[model samples]
Target: MNQNVRNHRFRKGIAGLGALATAAAGLFVGTAGATADTTEPVDPQLAVYVEVNSNDLANVADYTLAESGEAAIDMAMIFAANINYDGEKAYLHFNERVTETLENAQTQIRPVQAKGTKVLLSVLGNHQGAGFANFSSFEEADAFAAQLEDAVDTYGLDGIDFDDEWTEYGANGTPQPNAQSFGWLATALRDRLGPDKIISLYAIGPTYTTTDFSLFDAAGVLDYAWNPYYPTYDAPTVPGLDDRGRLGAAAIDLSNTSAATAADFAERTVADGYGVYVAYNLTATDQSAYLSGITEALKGESTVYRAAPGDTTPPTVTIKSGAKYTKGDAEDGYKRISFGLHDEGQIDRLYVNGVLKDLTDDRWSDLNFVKSGAFGAVKGENTLQVLDVAGNTTEVSFVLTK
Candidate 1:
């Protein structure tokens, strides 16, 4: 899943949508092409990269969410959803409102760059509708290459992430129409971006069957691949493209109990030699707790932060200010309750009832994190708990009134 895809709620035709996204939502067709491959590999970068939604920059606008705008991270993929390919050119099409939102994201991302991360725009071709894979011939690939270069230069971006999935085929046994073109496109992008820029793809080792890995894995074509929520059965495969061929581990369930799960995956991949370790979409108040496991395996650091010492104080928890649930206050019987969970040390877990919930949209350093989202409250009681990494805890209970 391209986890950070925009909410494509624009009710316009592809033509109009294409026009709006680049020239304001009207579809424009483009040209394509093809290529062969190479096997030599480059060194893999052992660094941490994250995907933050450009559609909702506010969710990650805060410094706490900012992480290190620089060296603390390796790269941050600013996700731009639905960059449609028209057999002639590739275009990013979003409604006007979304366009403004992304512009804000572009500005907001500067802080992340300040801390040392290379922020790149990741354009994904939508799976359900017309996409890169939907183009009729190989020549359209060239069309996309030109347009993509324009976007990179226009936005002053560091690089691009090609996120394409296989949903274009009409039948089970049929061959993909743009497969060869896309391979050429990948090579074209590598050449256009030059040697230093970062280029990655969205695919796992074993699960992605439709894509011909060999085509895109040429020595200089790809830099990384995001194969999230890795399952044990698939095992690890050597990657294409030289330098830092890391596998991404999604943190949808990276928690206390699952730390070992992530650690094991990181260890084995590193042991295999060419692979690097990485984590995705993590928002814990204590981001270290989640990333520490992966880092331990990658660098063999003797001290795991989960076991490290500092502040031993219990965390403080409270319902965020301005929350309301009076008559007609909430939407569809679900009230949005925001929480402020903080600790002198690392805040580990924030749970509503017994199920743990992430209390912050952004990752907190060693003190605070904000968590907000809709809550399903019946006509009665609710409970919340916030725990520090050191095992100290805090709790809050309240009643909803209509």
Candidate 2:
């Protein structure tokens, strides 16, 4: 049971106790250091930040490396989350879509992780004065670090990526940006998250202007840092971080960036011995050709588009053979009713009596909810609704005789 779906159900009223039983089944793929069978990540990595607020995170798996047959993008970053101050303290806050993505990590995120592409959540500021550089105390930093570690552990994320922006330091009665706070927080995160877990920086804003070197192990704590601007070549000048840890050229916005410029960025990244190339805001539209410019320049191979265009047809719900209420065969209320849903387009939502009961990305031909008492069938009329990713919907209603 996805938490978002569960929340939806609660707002609409209780759907069933059956949903609670499936809650444990929604396990995250795994944490860092758990990639035992995955392909080793490529060098001179092509990392992309996916805007989950607007696009599907699963889009990260759509591009494949032409030569190695692995994920073309080495890292898939969740574009952002915020550190918000809620009067008393600062805490991590994920927007609705980010929460949905993480809650559905097994379906939305695991496919990319399965391809050996690391998935990281990028944390930034929300103008509430809760940025990374204004922690005020080491304990405050450690407390925030624990929240991040818990999120990683709970969601099976690869690690954290820091993007220092929009913090509005000195607002909301919070301390202004300090030199030691960022280093203290980063150090505490590295200490708690373990060595294999990734810790990256966006290499812009206060993370550069305010971070102090002697307070934190820059080389040891951060795994990668990339320039935040687009179509530019400027490596971050953080002390202790080397060239291989720095990705200094050709950050691009896929929706608007020029391919040739991206190619030049990749060319520079490789020629200058930078360890990573960065792209942002990948969408459902195919960008293999645009991405190939970077891949060909960096890896000497073309990028492959492996995603099939989504099906647009609506899904169907049918009363299966054993459904007594629909057939008018059982006068007494039936505890179990059988039904099947079919969709080549892939069913993404299942609603019962106007409440969301299940959500998934899996395509289905004939999925049945026959067991577990027909997913909490109650006396009187019941309605089942099904929908696909393309927003097509189908609904069926049946009445149990009193």
The TM-scores of all predictions, comma-separated, are 0.51, 0.66
| Candidates' RMSD to native | 20.4, 19.6
- Runs off by more than 4 Å, candidate 2: 1-42, 307-402
The TM-score that candidate 2 achieves is 0.66
Top TM-score hit: 2
Instruction: Tell me how far the alpha carbon of residue 333 in candidate 2 is from the true structure, in angstroms, after superposition.
Output: 69
RMSD of 1: 20.4
Candidate 1 C-alpha lDDT tens digits along 153-247: 66566777765532344332323544455566667777777888776665421113334457665556766654323232122222353233343
**Clashing residue pairs, candidate 2?**
none
Candidate 1 wrongly placed segments (more than 4 Å): 1-70, 85-90, 94-102, 105-107, 166-175, 204-217, 229-257, 299-402
Question: How far off is residue 141 in model 1, in Å?
Answer: 1.0
Per-candidate clash tally: 43, 0
